[model samples]
Target: MQIQDLPYPDPGVPDARSGPRFLWWLFRNQLGGQVRSLAWGLVHFLSVSALPFCVGYAVQAVVDRSGTRLALAGGLLALACAGNAIGDTFLHRAAITNWITAAARVQQLLARKAATLGSALTRRVAAGEVVAVSTGDVEKIGWFVEAVSRFTAAALTILFVCVGLVVYQPSLGVVVAVGLPVLALAVLPLLPRATRRADFQREKAGRATELASDTVAGLRVLRGIGGEELFLDRYRSASQEVRHAAVRSARMWSLISAIQVLLPGLLLIAVVWHGVGLAREGRISVGELVTVYSSVMVMTYPLRHFEEIAMAYSFSRPSARRAARVLSLRRATSEDGSQAGTAPKGDLYDPATGLLAPTGRFTAVVCGDPDAAGRLAERLGGHPSSTEEEPSVLLGGVPLDELPLSAARTAVLVQDKDPVLLSGTLRELLDVPASGDVDAREALTAAQCEDVLAALVQGSLGAEDPLDARITERGRSLSGGQRQRLALARSLFTDPEVLVLDEPTSAVDSHTEARVAEGVRELRAGRTTVVFTSSPLLLDRADRVVLVHEGEVVAVGVHRDLVHKEPRYRAVVTRETEPEPEEPHDLQELEELEEIEETA
Candidate 1:
């Protein structure tokens, strides 16, 4: 596959059984490109290696004083140089194509997995690890894949040169043939130590990356709590640890490099020493001695491939393992068993906790535990839970998990307590796949997002429309309340058959919360809306209020009725006791005051 043909029509499922297996799968998928690279690489290396032979022949021709022989050698030298140039150019092109395509394939696989797993992905894997894998790890994997063809060509070149030498001169050829293998294998013992140190470095680096990610994500919270310095110190320590590990790994690899150079240098000396003795004994010509020396020198270039391939494998192994682990993750809902192109319409029901949200009504869920409330919200939307045996929520008496993911998502939408706004223009943020009569303007009005619009205008070009104003990543530039309102506006704009909101107004004031509650009730009048909240302003607007205590429905009624009768509900919502009424004034004191006024 070429770079222009990128973003493959079908990236195909990866073989994530094991790290090595995954690497093998990638190589197999790109076999055509790899072969092309190998072929060109072979041409290049062979032409370069043949140059020494051409020079030796030219020397011999000069010694013989034959004009025709000298012309032949010159022609052959020019041909070899031309071949080398063409091979080198094509080899580079093929290698780059192989690298980019391989990386793109892996990246596509990762993106597919991430889309399937959704929010649960971060829970299973660290955010920083995911970042590292998708970025640095992907490059490492591509490096290894691209190295394979070159390494193969180098090995073949070494073999061809050795055979040619043996045919031309046995005494020097034997020395070279024996020494080349020793040079390649001599560094094998040091590899284990090098690999161990590399693994250590990678581990420490992952931790450091994770620490930095966490610190950056929570920088605002840390500043609020006066703990920024503490986190900075922690990150500093992690970075130091990573640096130390990297230095140690570099030391080991440096030793391996030294060995690579030293062994080849020793072999070169031996080949030259042996060839000189053969020349002195009149066993071979001076041209043969020069050829042998040049051949040994050329062998050094190919021998280095062994070390390079080793380093590439050592680094890429762990990267591939991480990528495999991510790809191996399976969603709670089985994709194979999902019923395709089906969208169920009716009341949302979670069998796990017996929480039922009836059709065409605003139902409020009051759960004492916020985590439980969040889980219930996710369940209500047919989002896959972490459990295995627990059945998914149902829509219109059909298990939502059985429906295809796209259909399920279209039918029901869930907005979490902390929803994110992707970096883009305001219009782009609201550009979701939505149906029904709702639009951006109406949803914004219902969400009481006038302040958000004004903030956007003030933050950007004053003449620009609010919809055209840009929003920073995660809506970081906006205040918490503004961000929450914007998220609510986005969800409302979608206007799904069923909407599950988890504390949609938790950040807003009571007055704005009341307006938002009323607006939602009016806008979603004939749709199924489930709001998970404990605020009285929001609860008062619900057609039916259900209290979830200890993972089950404990009470169901209007918010006012529940507060009056259920002390637990009252405690959870208001978090205080009700005050008693005072007694009336005495009647005798009123009568005495009336008689005194009559006497006067």
Candidate 2:
């Protein structure tokens, strides 16, 4: 599958409210399990509430001078504690299990969507954003999902306590009922700011992650150009920004936490003060007031949860939005075309440009702009380029866009100038998909990789089997020419009906590149191949060459013929030979051309 055909997402401006909506979607889908989790949580919470009741009972029993009743109350208290412990253990385990499984499922779905969207995914979203979603964001989403039942149980417990208090002691109960809402709702004003700060923190974190990834990826280039220190300084600056954002986020959460603690304490003081006045007036008994005090203290636990839920939601909402954005990307599929599994017989036709790459022929396309050639290669390989007009690229007579991805891939392949070589053995490096049972010997010979194999052999103890020798990541262990030949050999082994190579030997010397052109022709005989290159040797070898100037084909002929016939083609192929404004002598121009050609 080509990368450009991978699904791309069009995530509009992310709504702050999307987090709640996402949670609701998850909740609805897992309602049965959620209900069970909530039920267990409630049982556990109610069992806990028994502690306060037992204290209230024991106080009354002692006041009444009933030893037997006091003993029974203590026993009841022990039983309630045991039940709460058991229930809480199971409750936590069940809830956490649900959260993990749900998160895993969502991540899997996102990964599948990403694969379908292919290269388009990276085009729309930063690599770091995708990384964050899979790692950090997924876990945050899970926490929010599991927090649901716990939060619900806490809310219910609060409601139950308020009603019970009112029934037991009407005056104290009224204050307790009124104050609980104040504790729960007091943090509302700070929530918006906290969430905004959290979002900023997450965004900065993602950017830092992206910067780090980019820096690591180009570390070799950066070092070669003496720009490593410059990048390091930039990264340090980005880190400082992240640190500041985190501090702001932490401050907001801390303020919410302070209110969570202070407000409840203030409510407790108010309840105790009012309860004592009523007791002095003979409206309520001492034991009842003690019960009221115990209840208010217990109420602190649930109020603490209010603060916890707020903080968790604040952090997790942005994460969920990020994950949602990734998930929402649609895989690239043809909108209007036949879904035929069959491939066209010969040649590739770009209807938009009226260009044809004839079957079983070596066609050289010379674009005035290198970028234009790259775009054309991308389109020919059944993928979209960043061209303003969405044009159809046809393989044989059938539109490439119309064919199923598998068919399109089998029939056409585009080898980019710089292709990725994953870390593995030499054999694995040349083992292209669908090229089954192709020994390393045949492919190495075809791409003239004898030097590459010899290098692998001389480097290590396990030298007899060069294919088994380990390749460093990105083939950094090998020279540029060796890497290019290995990539070319891998592509040759695939033996696609139509092979499109974009400057396959751009990094190699003339000797190796000329050999590669010869090897490519010998190995891919009677197969349609289009090479986008300005190399004299490769162009000379083409059966028919097409020179594209300013996005249109201006001349069609062999390399020597075009060099003699087309001035633009000559200037491009021998760019280094062209007399510079500063040095216009023919002798100097010839010297420069010889030097450039000799270097190549």
Candidate 3:
């Protein structure tokens, strides 16, 4: 495959049972490639095993009485070396190819799963965890997968060497055959502790990554509230924890490396000592002794691979489990299975709040608690808007969960108060995904975005087309009101069957806000539109306003009608209208709500 076509692997199963299983499943699927690589590796390794024998033959010939025989043995040794070099080159390349492709496949699976789960993925798994899994974890899995072939090649070569030694010198061969097993199995006792340490280190690293992501995403708000220091301190603590875990993990690995080295060295020494004795007793010739020594020495190469495979697996198994958990997440709850792609053919209803938004009407949800109002809007659009409760939101008499994700999203579009201002031009921001189908000009007019268009034409830095002018990330360059208007324009452009707007005009001036409220009512005359706002101007425009108090709709009517009939609704809206000091009682809570709006 070409470099550009390299597939990104995304194996999202992160649970304990799923990690190894995912690898196994992938192995089964790619068994043919693996088998081909394995066959090549075996041939390469077998050819490589002839080097020590050739060296022994050359040594014996030089020690004996002939010049021509010595030259012939030397030539054979050179041929063996050349053969080994060629075999090793192809073996390494084939192994690496398998590793890279496997990693790419895993990454692809993960990306697919992330898209399938979308917003829900973050709600369940931390953003950092996903990032780490897609990057570092996948590489580790690939290492382990590739290590399998290396370990197999090493084991087979070692066995061949040991058997050859036994034929050359029975006494030394027996010593080697028995000692190799000891070196391979000796590290078993320490493996459990090493695996545990590696797992702990990985967990801390994931946490540190998550903390950094959160810090960066909230850097703007954190700076606004002067909480950067607090978050920085938290991040420092997380980093320190990761450092400690890494150090512990390093210590374990260092110890294992030492054992791997010492055990092989000791075995070599014992085998040599036994071979020397056999040679002195006249049971073995000098060339045979050299052959025995050479065989044991060559065996060290394979043993090292054995240890490497163990270490690779020690880290990868847990990482695979984490990836498995993410992939295993079902796209949607099965309870909503029957309702998917089917509609109830009536108005939408929320069971928890006892709020009903009739189909094809301009309804306003006025909540005394802004949090409650935001949550209500989320439920109406099929997102879990409640923290402690899963409110039931129905569309056309059918539950939102019952509708397929696409159907639900198409039927009801919740334009959050603070719409996400992606890095693009004002035109692109307003274009949205459905711009081609909807009338962009009409939507812009309804959203009162004439100023936005003027700014794009006059102030944009690049691209002559106003629609093509690029905006900065999060639209930080634009005023809050401009961003809100652009988001409103985008939502209106969708022309969804049900349009839910949460505090849609929070950043605009009263006059502009009045125009937007009126424009929205005029544009969505027959469609189901729910506006979550307490602005008297917007509320007055609502055909009917449902007053939400303590998570329940206590009163329902027009703005003036509710102010007269519901005392709590009047107080809440009045409080919001009144100007207060910069330090609001629930300042943090209010800021979070604003941030949520910005994300819409």
Give the candidate number with the greatest TM-score.
1
Write candidate 1's Cα lDDT for 180-278 as tens digits: 888888999999889888888888888898899888988888999999999999999999999999999999999999998998889888878887888
Per-model TM-score versus the true fold: 0.93, 0.84, 0.83
**What is candidate 3's local distance difference test score?**
0.78
lDDT of 2 by residue, 286-383 (tens): 77888888888887876777777787788888888887777665434442223557667777877665567889999988886887888778778877
lDDT of model 1 at position 338: 41
RMSD of every candidate to native, in Å, equals 8.3, 7.5, 8.6
Model 1 deviation from the true structure expressed as Cα RMSD, one decimal place: 8.3
lDDT (Cα, tens digit) per residue for candidate 3, span 1-600 = 322556633333333357888777766655655776677777667666776777777777878866887888778777777767777787777778778877887888787667555455676788888988999999999888877877887787778777876786677788888888888889889989999999999999988998998788677789899999999999999999999999999999899889988988888788778778878898877887787777767767777887788888889988798888877766432323224474345688989888888988899888867766776787777777224455457776677765666667667788776667788665666654562556878888999988887786676766677678777787776788998998898899888888899999998999999999889998888888999988898988999989888878788888887788777888887773645667546979799879999999
The residue-level lDDT of candidate 3 at 262 comes to 92
State candidate 3's TM-score: 0.83
lDDT, each prediction: 0.88, 0.79, 0.78
| Higher-scoring candidate on lDDT, 1 or 2 | 1
TM-score-better candidate, 2 vs 3: 2
